[model samples]
Target: MKRFVVCKTCGARVSGLLDSPVALDFITKAEQELLSGGEYGNGDNGNVYISTSDKHHLSYHQDQNRLIGCCGPSPYGLPNLVCICKSEIGREVTDCCTAHYVMLYKERIAIREDNTGLLEKVVSLPVAEDLKSQYEILINFGEIEIVLNALKM
Candidate 1:
């Protein structure tokens, strides 16, 4: 199975995952937007919901993808990603600026624009019971270094 993660804040070169998720939380909107075309400053201005895959990406790092905008970017922007992970997890992800990531109460679904430029639900992630796990999963820099070395890149 393929796994996805944002770059680590620690000294790790890149972020990878285990068969079990190491991250207790999802990636942040600020990071997600950066992954999308929402660059920090104008090389890029604000509100360019356009998708660009040609942006420079680090080895083993795919900054952007099409047909699947992950659980992050949307035509509505990351600030609007409030309440994503919309699985009733009750983990309150306030990063969406309370814009409701899952509008109409559907988060994991993909909202695509048609030829007429109307956004609609093309597809969505299946609703599943949000697994509540015990114990903490921490990714220390030293552990990350080991994992980075294990990767092909």
Candidate 2:
């Protein structure tokens, strides 16, 4: 079977034969132990970012339709993401602590049923003053870490 990245804008399969999709969903350090795939955000555009620092990193969309998977970093001073990576890859500063993705559903990631898939969930991010307080707690004390989030599809 072959794999390709479909443009949400044009619905085009943007991949060549070099595309090799990973079959496992990775976990990050900060999210809760139990999670599920769902919608999360401020009712606008949303993104999902995850970590597998132990192995790899993955990005997708909460829309349960879009995807943004990484193809590992570059070595030739270029990149090899090959498909959707073109749009989302360089968007991040090479050293930025965060990863970027379109955030999609579980079936899209296609984790195997044997080793267990990465769990995901959605939560409302409070607004105004409450949002500010939460931001303070989240960014304070050098506690910056990865969060697997659900966003508005």
Per lDDT, the best of the predicted structures is: 2
* Ten residues in sequence with the least summed lDDT for candidate 1: 129-138
Q: Give one digit per residue, the lDDT tens place, for model 1 in 64-84.
A: 331123443343322222122
RMSD of each: 18.3, 18.8
Any idea what lDDT model 1 has? 0.21
Q: Estimate each model's TM-score.
A: 0.16, 0.19
Q: What clash pairs does model 2 have?
A: 36-120, 40-151, 60-102, 60-103, 60-104, 61-102, 61-103, 61-104, 62-103, 63-153
After superposition of all CA atoms, the RMSD between model 2 and the true structure is: 18.8
Q: Write the per-residue lDDT of candidate 2 for residues 25-108, one digit (tens) a residue.
A: 223512231112211111022322222211122232123212222332211232222223333321111122223222322212
TM-score of 2: 0.19
Candidate 2 regions exceeding 4 Å error are 16-22, 28-153
Q: Model 1, residue 90: displacement in angstroms?
A: 19
